[model samples]
Target: MQNKLYLDQRSNAFIILNLLMLWGWWMLYQLYALPVHYAKPYFALDKIPLYLEWSHLWFTTWLFVLLCICYLCTCLLLPHLQVAQVSVRWTLILSILGAGILNVMIYPVGAVDLFYYLTQIKLFAYYGENPYLTTFWPTYAHDELTPLSSFLSWPLVYGPAWLGLASLPIKFVGFDDLLTMLLAYKLFSLYCLLGCAWLIFKLLGGGAPGWYGAYVFAANPLVLFEAVANAHNDILLTLILLVALLGLRHRHILALPAFALAALVKVFILPLALGFAVALWRTRWPFRRIVGGSLCSLLIVFLLVAPFWGDGSIIERMQAAVEQQQTLRTAAPISLANEYAQTSGASAQQLEQLRIVFTASYGCLVLLALFFVRPLEHAMASIMLLLFLLVSSLFPWYLIPVFALLALHPRRLELGYMVVASLTGLLYYPLGVVAWQTEGLTLFQIQLVGATLLALPIVVFLVALLFQRRVELDQ
Candidate 1:
């Protein structure tokens, strides 16, 4: 009886800690509003003065301490959650709802991609213009939202399915009011996030009675910030991908259309879809059935994209995507390489050539995995890991698919996810208050820091793999 009471008290504390973290995120994001406003119009304005006038270095130090504490608290709570099963389920649901509501009002962090999404929707739904043909910047250049023009210079490179999916709620809200349209998109993202949580719970329910995996995912600080606060469409992408996997698990071949739809949401899901298709084939399913599904998926993809396809514009859009991919630098190996080359005084032509080589090499690695990795979960994890390592640009939100895949097999990957995802939040430092005053760290320096942070996990994983191999050899 005494032990039971003690366990209940500990579980209560765990629930409170999670709720506090959600509230903390809301407060932290509010702090961004002042800084972001001051930096807008391309930093042509004065920096906002803080109460204590904190130095960038000191502020970053404190921020790191806070995040580390959050990570440690989360790690401590997971085991307790396993014991206090029923309580944890209610906590997960409450935490997600609380975070989603709070994030709806928070300032976007790291990137303003949300605004670009809105602009594309407005163009397609309201202006009756094909977003593929009209870049948001040129169309809205003289409009009231022109201050955002600087970031929307790039044309729509998102897939046709994304445009279609994004257009629905946008059309419902009507485009004359930007804030309402913004809220509509955010609400849509929130719906996807809630769906992901429920789906994860259903997927993992057979083995465990607890909401351990779902709690880790839904209540993850990075996931909350990216999925809810930033209003990224990646949440929607992950939702459809989960649908495909769930359908495949039930042996429903119609899952192929869902997978195709997922791919059309973003081409990034292609490798994972292919991996799923291969897994389906290995089950002794008939070749004709697989071929038929593939044909149907292809047809669906073609039909969705056909309306958006313009005279010679498809080639132009493809080129734009290639250019965008080549120039991007974020928390990935290629970003580090690209920055190293640039800081070494490499010319534009040399940087472009290097990007091509990096991309080609990354392609080969993914192809090897698609052919060799058999299990759908393992293959999806492998593909996402490759992306995390090889992509030229990665944001915290980019980790959603990875988090979803690893939630299925978190026994090994959860710790790595927590560490890396927590550190990835530091990417927003450049947008913070002190950063504007001090001009922040250079992009290359930030990449170096990220490389060092992520490399620790890479080394640890490789060492573990090598140790496991040695044990097998000894056996």
Candidate 2:
């Protein structure tokens, strides 16, 4: 009885800690408002005050510490609470909802991608301009919300399904009111986040595992910060992917159309769709049925793209956007290689060759996993992790879907790596703030540090796994 009481107290403390950390993050994001305002038009980090830099560093570090504690508590205490019949699941739901609300209120200081999403929706829905064909700048230079976006020159890089789904809330909120529009998008993302959690719970067959998986995705600070606060559409993509997976689990033919819809949100999901096809085949689905499913998927894609297909320039614009993204050297192994090439005076052709090699290797590994990995969820999780490591351009929010996938089949090693990667990946932002202010802190230096941070988790996980194996062998 005493132990039960003690377990209940720990569970309560965990809930309180999670809420407090989220509130702390909300407060920390508020500090970015002035800096964001000053850095408008391009969102460049130039001429920031020394005091603001120090404050950002201190506050970001403290928040991260709290986030680590929250994650650890979830990992260690959740199962115990479940055993004690502490009503922890309901508490988790309330805490997640509270966190979502707080995050929606916070400024999107982490990434200004939310502004770009709004601009695209406005261009398409309000101005009747095809976002795929038109750039945000020069065309809409005088618009009030133009200055808020950082991607001034890029056309629509997102898929049409995303545009179609994202347009609804902005239209309802009235695009003329920017604040309300922002709120609508944030709320939309929050809904998607919750939807992903619900699907995960349902997929896992509702019990301790289901609740744990739900909490893992819903309560993750990285998901809250990126999906709710920054309002990235990745959460929506994840939601669609989960829907597809759920359908597939039930052996429903509609899974194909759902997978197509998910792919239409982001082209990267094509590999997962391919994996889904393999799964269908392995299950001895009839050839004619597979063809019919494929047709349905293609039909859905056509319907989504038909409205945006203007004069065939949308294709060219999409290709251009892909090329533009390829040119960027960001947080990934390729980014580190690019830094090396610059310092070594290596030919650009060499770097291109390296990228091609990585791309090919990713394709091969994905094919192997599709054929060999048992259960579609594990295959999807492996594919997502491969994309994170092997893709030329990586972002922290890309891992949002990874958490959702991992939730479907929670393994300690993969989950721990993701948790660590999320933490280290986000270090890029605060590090950028300080890098801009401190003398001699170049972008190359930052990339190098980022690479090291990303690699640490892999090393630690590998070592721990090896030690565990050795112990088992001895036993």
Candidate 3:
């Protein structure tokens, strides 16, 4: 590939990053203008117009279309900017541009987890109901309130700390409108993304491959769209997980709180937590120190969560949370079967039959991860993580941490995971925009399954090569 001037190792990367930023901001401005004019006026989704005069509906629609095109252009530019060895100024500019586009799109489309995050918090803010104890908005929907706006279910699927963080926006952002809340959540997410970048830079001397970092994350349209644009708390949690993993690599005791807190925000990190705890145990920490530390982490999360949880019966609410969140690790074979059984409308008898099959399949994967997969321990752990993303229920932003790992440690085999995952994550965006029944996922999404399978052979080949390298090193 012929490299462009100043765009290659020749000139600064800072320039391109900034240019992308401007492009992204312009797109956001267009997004903010649209719903005020069109959505509120015509659909009355918000019905009450706050920003623009409802009469400007026609103009708002035009502006929204233009912004979508502009956002697309920005996305295309990011990959190139990432590949270029640009100056830091351009990098920051690009970073902000990425952030701008993310918040802009998140404010409008309402896809991904952005919706669930807001509605859950709004319940606590508007009515003073405990998010942990709240049921579907059906109770509120009857008071002439639109269920569409007030309706949220299963907020407890989120770990407790997530509720607190989501609640923080309620104070400053206010319950005045969804836009207010959307931006607030995204602002927090922006902080997380920056922290992840800084952490990666600190860990790897000479910096993680700049272009590689940008290409995999900083500039990926899917990441921007799902994380910042959509307000998925999973994005924030993913960063915490990444930071914690990097800390583990460095054996930073201080950073353990971040990982523990991450698990508090989302319980999906159970295996990673267990893995680390076991590693720690092997290092001979006293029983009390290990037990107390883990318990103390949970207690801290509870203290933060205590203010929001009310309605007395704490244990009942806790029990309810446990029942509702049963399938969080759904990609695990047993959990996947349970989810499939529930959603596919199978009979209880059928479910019981399927459980046996699921248990057996999961046992096989566990065995592979533990033993036969020794050479690719890291890679196997990663596969288990990816399996957690698929087969199980997952919010799009949940893919962020694993993607960070891949971006930092990309072998040819893992890059294949990146490409497929990036596409699947992108597909999630349109679900909120296009009518679901109309956009019904096509077979192309199936293309990822193919990529995964074909890529496995390469993964196996890579494993062989790594073993060879290890033998040579031993000599």
The most accurate candidate by TM-score is 2
Candidate 3 residue 87 C-alpha distance from true site, Å: 2.6
Total clashing pairs for each candidate = 0, 0, 15
lDDT of 1 by residue, 109-139 (tens): 4457677677777778877877777776766
Q: What is the per-residue lDDT of model 3 for residues 26-49, given as tens digits with 9 covering 90 to 100?
A: 554454543353223122213324
Per-model CA lDDT versus the true structure? 0.67, 0.76, 0.52
Deviation from truth (RMSD, Å), model 3: 7.5
Query: What TM-score, over all chains together, does every model reach?
Result: 0.85, 0.90, 0.67
Candidate 1 positional error at 168, Å: 1.7
Higher lDDT: candidate 1 or 3? 1
Misplaced by over 4 Å in model 1 are 29-52, 55-68, 71-76, 82-86, 206-210, 342-364, 367-375, 427-443, 453-475
lDDT of candidate 3 vs native? 0.52
Q: Per-residue CA lDDT of candidate 2, range 1-475, in tens?
A: 9987897798788777767766666675566443344235433233334346476567766686678567766766686676335556667877789888878876676778888888888888988998898877889888877877867688798899999999999888797667788789999999999899899989999888888888888888788888998788999999999998887878777888998999888887777867786778677777776788789998998899888888787888887897788667566776666677777888889878878887898888778666555456766766766675676466778878877876786677657776786677666567656665568877787766655666456446545544554566679
Candidate order by lDDT, highest to lowest? 2, 1, 3
